[model samples]
Target: MSAAGSSTESARRVAVITGASSGIGAAAAYALAQAGWDVVLGARRLERLQEVAEATGGRAIALDVTDQASVDNFASQIERADLLVNNAGGAKGLERFLDTDMEHWEWMYNTNVLGTVRMTKALLPKLRASGDGLIINIGSKAGLDPYENGSGYNAAKFGLKALTRVLRIEEIADGHPVRVTEIDPGRVATDFSLVRFDGDQKRADAVYADKLNLSAADIAEAIRWVASLPPHMNIDTMNIMPRDQA
Candidate 1:
């Protein structure tokens, strides 16, 4: 962390990134830090978050979006937040809806939908305090178009889509300056598949095998661009896919 009253730290904006321990969240931290934003990284994994924070010159705070207390504690550490990247979300299983374990559904919804809610609500005050706050909710292509055996993840992302839209409407209704954007990407190569398959490396590896896929950095760049835009500009929603994803 930079010394208090340091001009460099004071001049730069602060961005809080959830799920910053890995994948898109970690990538976003580096990208934002590089672009002169003081990033606050949050995740359940302390070691990974710490490493990312050190690498990006940011701060690491243990945050579990699924836990309200953790979210509150995480928010308490952030005195100022110009941007909140709700990136701490993922899929859990590939079984069809009927055959899928309920536990899979619960975890997916909790992490992807409710988790975003917890963080957004916790950080909204500061984001509003920024005078030109921005919230970027990381979404998935599954949210846009569901696929076979993706019932749980699809449901979570779709719910996230609705949540993002409603929040945008509410803020607009209240006439707040907060900006909301949802970026949905397709075929990003990350640990996402591995986690979804319960660490089955072969199954996870096959998802992107012999196919074009986006990197975590690619989605992170989109987030950076959206955040860097003028306050009056709103991306609304953006869907980025690999050239060959279709």
Candidate 2:
């Protein structure tokens, strides 16, 4: 990756992506690496993160987004970053509010809500230093419309959308060139449901059994496009889903 604010014309840009061990985060890391951006990956699973980093020829760091010290240290290690992809989050289960475990609710709140904020806060300095920074928050369609038994997950995403909107405005007002973008995608065939169900393969597979689903590559491409835009251009928001999905 190029040094921060260097004058070399052909210097490669740097991108930092969280949750880069698998799913959309991994796909985006590979895509960015291939696009000539030096990438730094962060995730809880060190082995998986190492695998993706080696495959993409990028750097990897073990990160637990819920932990403040970890996030702070990771931010300090990044000297320059033109893009920050906040993609670390997941649901717990499909259960009514009254039936859900309080621990599940706490877990969702910690990772999905506070985790994003911690990353953004920690990275803002480096992002601002780059002079052409982009922040992409991976939201979900559930944020737009809450479904039965999806109260906790939906609430976190909805808060994320609001957070992005506010950050966009604040950054602009502060004369920072940082751009915030949100990509709210519908259901995709990923380890998302599997983790939510605590490794119930049968139940996870059932979510996409009869329908065409989005791949991690799909969302990765969208993120790449948003990050590749001209300095004067910004893709503020995008929502993508499979054709069969409504």
Candidate 3:
């Protein structure tokens, strides 16, 4: 693989993207690769991960966000990282609070909150060492404005936003070169709803049946813009949605 940050030469930048099997994460991986950053793709599916890695000429590692061992192993395999895209989170069950199962809530908490934390902790040192590191946490607009029957998903994303903010301040205080950004997207047309609905394709289709929506490429472009900025500048946070979404 190209040396980390070779695109800039002054500093080699390497990006690690999680949940890169498909959708936004996969698009982001391609965008970074196109921009000349060596990329590392992480996800649970080896076959899909291999596809992305081969396409981008990057590396792929099997990663299960909710499992500590898997997360650790993924981190250990990385040599240097300039960007960590914590994009491996999603909503599990969309039932009302009273009807929500504990398993669903647990899944959300583990994957969204704990998973981000696990990946951040494992890669922080490399980020700090890079001298101009960035962390982009993928979140949802629902995290800011809740929707009915979205308690579990909302809670996890809300926590993710909070975590990103806190890390931003703490890293600056510690004189670290790391920056944290949280991207909250609204109604993206991806497999997100399908996964949320537990493989119910028809229900998933209904989410954006009559509405304009952002594509995974849209978010990936935004991410690339933020990462390509000068080392001294950071985008901090952004919220993107289709014009018709609101």
Candidate 4:
């Protein structure tokens, strides 16, 4: 290919996804890549990231949101990101406030709240330079409703909601073209339960056995639709759940 052709192709809109090793983040990477965006995936798992990148014709970067150096290095790998999906988060343990392991709460907070903050800060500049930037933060139903044994996870997601809101408000007030969206999904069957239960497959399977749960693809489609909208239109928050969940 000619140098000009290569440059033109490289100039396409870039989309950076955190936690792109699996589940919702991976799904988003594939969806955006198929739609012609230059997808750059970030995750701690290099092999998994490479696999996703290969499948989607994207690039992979090693990222650990809880660590500043890792995040800075990851940010350096992406030049112009018009879309940033902060999906690198998970529930640690389903425990009531009193019964909770404090360490679990820390993990949840660091991954969900702090992680989003770190990634957003690192990518904000590139996003702003794009002339039209968008951030999609994946939240949860727990953010809206506190339930038994959901204190830690709920707290983290609630914090994310606040971050999403404040960021949108600040950007709008500052007269920036960056759009922020928070997608709160309920009961999507993923490895969420397994991780929450510390790699217990049975526990994970039971969570979705009889329920009509949303797939990673379902969430990915919503993300794709939101990203496809004109720059002037912004979807603030979308609460998605299975009919049964409602």
**Model 2 clashing residue pairs (backbone):** none
lDDT of 2 by residue, 56-121 (tens): 999999899999999988888888888999999999988998897888888988898899999999
Q: Candidate 1, after superposition: displacement of residue 186 in Å?
A: 0.4
- By summed lDDT, the worst window of 10 consecutive residues in model 4 runs over 1-10
**Against the hidden true structure, what lDDT does model 2 obtain?**
0.90
Q: Give the best candidate by lDDT.
A: 1
Stretches of candidate 3 above 4 Å error? 1-5, 8-11
Rank order (by lDDT, best first):
1, 4, 3, 2
- Distance from true location, Cα of 157 in model 3, Å: 0.5
lDDT against the true structure, each candidate: 0.92, 0.90, 0.90, 0.90
Candidate 4 displacement at residue 122 in angstroms: 0.5
Residue 213 error, candidate 2, Å: 0.3
TM-score-wise, the better of 1 and 3 is: 1
Model 1 spans with C-alpha error above 4 angstroms: 1-8
Off by over 4 Å in 2: 1-10
**Candidate 3 displacement at residue 69 in angstroms:** 0.7
Estimate the TM-score for candidate 2. Answer: 0.95
